[model samples]
Target: MSQPNTSPSGRPATLAPLFKASAGDPLLAMMLASGGDERIAAGPDGRNRYGASARPEAGEIWFSSSTASGVSRRGWQAASAALPFAFSAGESEDWFSDLRRRLLNLLAPPGAQAVFCASGTQAEYAALALAGARARPGQKIVNILVGPEETGRGAPLAASGRHFLNSAPFGSGRAGFALDGWEGAAALAALPLRNGAGAPLPADEIDARVCALVRVARARGAHALVHLLDSSKTGLSAISRDCATKLLRDNPDDVTVVVDACQLRCAPAQVRADLDAGFLVMVSGSKFLGGPAFSGALLVPGGFAESLAARDQDIPWPEGLADHFAYFDWPPLLRDRIAGPFGARCNSGLGLRWTAALAELEAYCALDPALIEMAKACFQGEARRQILMTPGLEMDESGGEPTLIPIMMRGAEKGAADAALRKLRRRGLHLGQTVPIGGREALRLCLSAPQIVDFAWRYREIGDQNFAFGPLRADLEKLFTAWGALLG
Candidate 1:
């Protein structure tokens, strides 16, 4: 019955009614109208994320954490200035060397046992390259993932499990898979060592556990290379942890383990432990740390790294590059020429350095001590309101990453959801539309917004109503007071 209105600063006054709303995304409308047609207009109006594209008009922009965090302008400026420096991989001899030695520089460690890669794809490629060089003919290699049947996190298929499939001899013409649960426990107590559908070996009985892989690799002989992508947001994959505990207990010396830490770089202690356990680890600079995009690193055991020197140069190794998992490839060298200090398996051409992001993360790595406390305090008041305001949105009260929030509308179907998004977009609110996820269309809001605009104060006064940023409450009410109107 009452109308909602905004004060000069875009704050809501009270339980306001809807404002006049349009059906298309506000920015898209601006861009399209600039052309006056459904097809996008061209010329010097605006530039899109893809670069020089007329799709994104001059004033209108697609929100992406990719180019910059929509958090604060200053934060974005700082990030860009740091890019060139960040693109250079840190080495003891480089400008970033000192920074890498610190805890904040997890993506690129000082005194790197190996250069992980400038990108995750490259890091994975590096790992595969190592595998090709090391695996005995007929030995199988495996790639791993986390998440359940449909909801599990999948690294691009181009990147994750394809390595072994490409390395034929050990595969018995068959590929290997290493899967784990969200909690670092095995999926049905299965190990990566086992081939598909092979009966899992018993954990308590070491011999039985050994049999799983023994049987799978039998046709290819007893050799196999295995990779574990720490798709687990926390640290260890459920299956990997369970298997690791048993594997180390029974026969640690027999298995070669490599971990994809590309997503788990923030969890340093866990990564260090994985390295100590003789697993090679890959990590990226972006994701959690919000660093430069094309930067990441890998950690290899001192012994495993040395093993590279033993390879015969006469043999040409397969290229191990991927779209996401790994990077870099070393050129073949004469056996006698290989007698000195080595750099890294891969090098970032733009140099895959995220110097600035790592510098920024120095404080976050110390998060248990300082910044996290401030963040908690900042969110304390808003947390209650958010928990209450979200009528049918999905948020895990139990446990999940605090940075990105993935949500969905309770009753809205795909088309309905899309239409509503278009309506919201016409206003200035600028939230993301639903994308296909886990086989269903869902919406995601990825942010840990740095304070810029006063959001909490506005919500207390108005619910889901955009200020000047959105259509007024009275107008929205006229548009959708009934279910039939929305249906049409």
Candidate 2:
């Protein structure tokens, strides 16, 4: 097969194949088919409406991982390599099992298991299914969602056990309908991380709100699923890990805490710690991991799945989930326990996405810890400084990790910020979508694993002095210059 045509500068043309295939491979086609409604539609130019293409477009500047990112070259190669194993007859099951194991080995502790989902929102639904399955007869699952405003738009609906979007990622269901067997099985209690003024609530106050919600659930003999936000869109953590640990300890039978680390800005150590504390962790490879968009997983702590399997009571599989999850999505121990008619199938696109993500993650994990920190610090510090110095922009001071910087547009009208974003796009620069902060909307400048890795390689080549005056600073200067022109 001939390689897809490229421009003189080696950038892929608008209608280039998603991969380097001369002819369309059915397995490769599944990569684009694995996501939700949003992933399926593309404009005439062969890019999504968001102006992102499945293949890497070297000409575009991407700082939009907080929203979505085009696949990195490294990730694309990894996915391409896995095509044979994924397509091999009878090997698909083992392929998926291997993927689940690889992910756990890299991101979780011993005995941990994972179930793949197409997106973070679907992972929320998977968590809900698990919580619901464990609930005693007549017990309501009280879903305590932290910082819903700062998370995915569909997250609250997923927490309530309904389809977050109009179309399911895999299965068939109308939006707003309860998952099969989940009708009236759950209730939602939202705890906004920020106050009315858009300032993040104090950790103590946030902790109190979580505890109060759990108390109310307990009073009603409900099962409490506390959705803790490790990092939000603007880099805010709503509840402290200490609070989550105490809640689980105080009510071991009734409370289940799940960490929403979807942004994946924190260290791997943090994820392990959450699993160690007996909390479920949800992460997205598409975010800070810098994989192609729509890869997600629900990390199950050691002994959790085993315990669920050991229960003598009948654990009825939620029929509604059949549309969203496959039989092999769960670990072997629980697969048979889930009495569903769904066959042993999996999402090929999801497997490919994770393959790409693991490639990026392994490369990232191989770097010296100090070097990674240095790159992150330098990038964050430089970005913050530039945002402060730029006219018509102000930074969000609610601090978490420095990986994502959200900046507000000063004195801009309702549509002006969006217009600036489009202008930036035309200039070959992309940023995170605007997020509503208190009364204002802010655009996020995000860092990804590939970006850091690129810096690491350059830093090694040029040494300290030249590295300081090199591409990292130059890129930021260019970004801010384009940004400033739009504001003017």
Candidate 3:
């Protein structure tokens, strides 16, 4: 059969033939069936009713971080300069590395090594591969701990034969583990960090359990990769401090820990402290920074860099995935044996995405701490009050001061939650995906800097609940009005 014709811009003439041709590819088939195209319904303003719109919507209220982000005016301005370059550049010109440096300087400490990936999942796969490589040569198993929740859409796709330890409440604890078919790994173990109600386990008990797990894995000669949850869909600061300390402080040999900060919501001080304590941290530009979707970077500190660099072989990434990464962007030491098919330049939109992220970072850095605190208080208070009055929504109070609110939709079936989302979108308000929590359908409304700052600009006259000179009351009223009507 003749291949599909190409458009002038080089895209397939039609997606239908491509979908049919993709019958042998599981991932492609899933994409065609996932309704992703319909899910991002565009509004009259040219933005997805969800965020991630290329253009601005004057009054759109976005509470969706599980999905992509909306472009801010400043972000758009920053990204615009790169469009010509992205569309016309013939060869890669260290654009990704430059972006990596800017992000590291803003988010991490000096001397921290960086690697840019297509998405959080790509960075995570590299981390996992490095973790397995750090194991002793004769060891055939590299067991890992995944906590709070796995929100990176590409994570499972990257795990080939590794064992995962579930640290989320009521999580399966073991994914990708098969005794008979085990190839890249040996065994898996899972421990609940929180109970079914979202309350964490006792600190001492958690510490003891983790220590025991590590010791047992050591005894069995398995390499342990401990994942510390910095923030994910469940909420920020989801890990138990005591448990993380025990795992990081006095751990067994052949163990490595990575702080999953992919949500990009963690503070600079938090990241510094974690890196100072010798843990690998992964962060993304797409989440809190409001950049375009699928941009990620890994901050490799001294010890982890040394370990990963010492390995002479490349991490056995999935077949055909090397093309998606900018291996040259990795720290020079760690780039030792990573072979190519590597791009000559940044991925299609990465340069523009990073530019947008850097623009947001600049604004965020210049904000007064007092203003930030005031905005946080205002949004949290309003969100909590709104949740109480909304009929179908209930808050998941398993974590901190409601940075990312997880809610279960009452009377909504497995996929009925999407209908509620659609209704909200039609009203020009966008919430995140309806995720699965404990066999029930759930959704998240994440607080973002752009949202808060925009509100501050639009409602500059209105005072907050504390009678402070911040947080426009009108914005909250608009959001709550839309929310109540949609869910009520």
State the lDDT of candidate 1 residue by residue for 320-372, as single tens digits.
Answer: 22222211222222112132222332232222224434544554453443334
lDDT, candidate 2, 1-488, per-residue tens: 11223222222344345344654444464465454556544556656656676667787888888988877888888887776554441333677777888888778999888988878988987788778667787688999999998898889988998876666656566678888777887899998888778888889998998899999999999999998898899999978888999999999889988999999888888899899999999999989998877788999887787788788754555777777776567776666566664533656667788889999888887777777888888887888889878888988878666888888898977877778888887777888888888888898998898888877777777578347436777878899989998887
Better model by TM-score: candidate 2 vs candidate 3: 2
Over 4 Å off, model 2: 1-21, 24-30, 33-35, 89-91, 465-469
TM-score for each of the candidates? 0.54, 0.92, 0.76
Candidate-wise lDDT, in order: 0.37, 0.79, 0.59
Kindly report which residue stretches of model 3 are placed more than 4 angstroms away from their true locations once superposed. 1-51, 87-92, 148-150, 153-200, 203-205, 236-242, 245-253, 310-320, 341-345, 409-414, 436-440, 455-472
Worst 10 residues of 3 by lDDT: 28-37
lDDT tens readout by residue for model 3, 283-400: 8776777765546777778766775566666544443334345434465566654543343333535556667778887677666666677677777777787778777778777656
Supply the TM-score for candidate 2: 0.92
State residue 230's C-alpha deviation in candidate 3, in Å.
1.3
How many Å off is the CA of 227 in candidate 3? Answer: 0.5
